[model samples]
Target chain A: MDKTYPSIEEAIVDVPDGAVIAIPGFFAAGVPRILLQALIKKGVKELTLACGCGPLLGATEELTQLVKNRQLKKVIDSYGLFRSATKGLQDPFEQAVRAGEIELEVYPMGTLAEKYRAAGAGIPAFYTPTGVGSIVEKNTVTNIVENRKPKETKVFDGEKYVLEYALKTDYAFIHAYMGDKEGNLVYRKTSRNFNHVMATAGKITIAEVENLMEPGEIDPDCVHTSGIYVQRVLKVPRIGFAITID
Target chain B: MAKKFEGLPREMIAMRASKEIKDGDYVNLGIGIPTLVSNWIEGKDVILQSEIGMTKTGPLAFNDDIDQDLINASCQPVTELPGIAYFDIFDSFSMIRGGYMDVIIMGALQVNGRGDYAGWANPAARGLDIGNIGGSMDLCAGATKLFLTMTHTAPDGAPKIVNEISFPLTVKGKVNMVFTDLAVIEITSEGPVLKEVYPGLTPEDIQSVTEPKLIIAPDLKEIEL
Candidate 1:
């Protein structure tokens, strides 16, 4: 079955308001720019964004635009704020958070990745030693939307670990280097980041690719994300957006 | 702003930290000064791993070689080396939290006497309470050895090697070694032992800048390059 979509707008057209959408990318790498642009045009409000960076500073402008448009209700992220040197240039997500317009939850990068992996793997919960003594263990207040519970801790072999639940989103937005009509995805270099796991964790995964190919074009050995996890594919022009910090 | 106290340069601290990596070791470099350690370990048997999901990463990619998709944790474009492998973030972090990394060099804001270092949150940023956690917590907690590279003192000349970390900790009692501008210190059971100091500087000088009283090593010598 071909999962190919004619347009980026059509691929993301079904995303509803107040949905938990996982956009996987690190910094500026592997971001689904066209899809995000379409998401902005869709103007879905009260979006709960699960992403690597909160609102990537000097990186993708789309996430910042989402925050600026007041479409985000909360952000579950690994990296919180990217401090801009200029006063007025602070990230819109950070500004929204400070103004109490949006909620923010931060986790250790490893734990965040494992949460998505657990969701995709059909695991309900797991334990980790990454955030046993930090604020991540302490900030466990129950919320209305996502029941933020206090993390449970246990000891194994005399080492302490904190219990973390799996994170499953309503939709996963992924950017890929190449995707087959069958939805098989191939990620390039470090751009792989959270895309592979997020694909599996979403109820419906939409992929925007730089190159669209036939089912047999991508070798089975090279497929980073199996087509079984992906639901829709849209081919977009390549966007060069890597931050160079000298 | 010029630092009030002079010691080894940032590159020197990274160079000294690089000495700790043995051949065939897998090293992960955090942002800032620790990222410089990559420059010193070139051609060595050590494999540099970027927490974003890459191993055997080469130096920063320059003109013509730059690939937007290939980058380090710092988000700077990077080059891939021979035998380089890439995976998803889950497997990458599994390699970190699974105790597979040999050494992880990181930057810190404050490190107390008990080996607890605070690197993620900066309470000082205007109106911002939380800072980026990134992969620091996992790298520090899961790596076989954690080598912290930072200035001996904060920009205001306040001792960063303090009696207690003022900022929220990344982890407690995980730092194995500290390479600062003024000295190379090892966090031992006995406490932080001053192993080496910048050439021509005395233990008294380092002690003055450090908030925690240090145990001078009997075999202390000038920091070797």
Candidate 2:
């Protein structure tokens, strides 16, 4: 059994700078605020943060600030957190994109998830039906074709295909309901967002637990992420949008 | 019959027949005057589930308490209820597509004789474009009962509820009732029947506003002002 840390900074103390980070939480529901704060306080730069709709998940605003402040290089994402916050992406980072300072790659949600799973499973790329004729599959290079055809056929219809490149990561962050000294995480209510998938998507997974329980304390069936994938655990605070199903 | 809320659009009064909404009913309110239904619902305990996730969503936030976090379908902040269960956009969509919706009230830009609906929002554009579809496609197909509340005509004084619609449709023949400030009309398979009319408005007046030929339901009566 490992010792539980009081704060997330200690939990992810070994995280290297410029590493790809897979963040859990969905649209502010499972955001590990303290864990994110630790990462920001460390002043790590040029890192790629991966997650599903982080803007809605609660980290978008902060990440935008980091990008705008030149603390990070780029973001592979779909939409910004704020609808009315900034000129374009509601972040200074987007202004930088306009100025050619960084690359803002927009990944449709499914494409983003598939790419991460592919990388985690050691697969190079995968095909998804998320962005067929949408603006999602444009700009630069790879074109993975789909074997399926359209409802109606014609020339110049381009192709009904999506080539999702891999989404490799160095660290993952999530907020769980409970955790043991060894880092198994449990989630309550809607808190079970994308934390489990994000955990396996990274090399080093750091979890911020609202409560620290003994090993096997949490029901085996409800245990989402196991201690095997999690490297560190931090005891944190419980905030909003909580519902106890148990 | 109900006391009309002052300052509400003429279209809202016609749609207020939500008196049929019983307790424990799951209702999805589409944008337009249909959203005003939440404010109109006082004595009923019907569960209002928004397509954007929040259930029984409150009005816009006053301050930065805007909870940049939780919001309704219109991209507005909202309060969370106790029984509410948040889900992925895809799963939430499954609920709508699986026909879990009981009643859906939407404001239509156009309602043809067949009761086809066409209001997809910001309809001023010639192209089939909107910020997002959310679950309109699913809601229209899934909801057991559908209601429409809207003005009698377009801003250009052209009729929106009519024999034939010019714009693209969101769902076909999904509308059961159409409500305007002048009158309430029910669309059966046969055609539209004038069900009720507002105070100070006559059946002739409603007929003038309505584009499709209106048949007076035998029990047609005045609406409560």
Each prediction's whole-model lDDT (CA): 0.83, 0.62
Q: Mind listing the fnat for each candidate?
A: 0.74, 0.02
Docking tier of model 2: it is incorrect
Q: Which stretches of candidate 1 lie over 4 Å from their true place?
A: A53-55, A83-89, A141-149, A242-246, B1-4
**Model 2's DockQ?**
0.10
Evaluate residue B4 in candidate 2 and report its C-alpha lDDT on the 0 to 100 scale.
25
Superposed model 2: Cα runs more than 4 Å off = A1-29, A32-60, A63-173, A181-206, A216-233, A237-246, B1-17, B30-93, B106-130, B148-175, B178-194, B202-225
Give lDDT tens digits, candidate 2, residues A1-246. Answer: 785776665677777767778775545566777777777788877776766544322555565557655666655554332333233333455455545465445444444555666666778776543333333334321111231223222233553455656776888887788988888887654446556666767787788888988887888786767888788888887766431100
Per-residue lDDT tens digits for candidate 1, residues A86-193, read 442365666677676787777888998988999999999998999767776766521222545566788999989888889999999999999999999999887889
The sequence of per-residue lDDT tens digits that candidate 1 reaches over residues B71-183 is 78888888878899988898989899989999999999999777889988775664555667888888877979988999998887888899977888899998889999989
Candidate 1 colliding pairs: none
After best superposition, candidate 2 residue B25: deviation in angstroms? 2.6
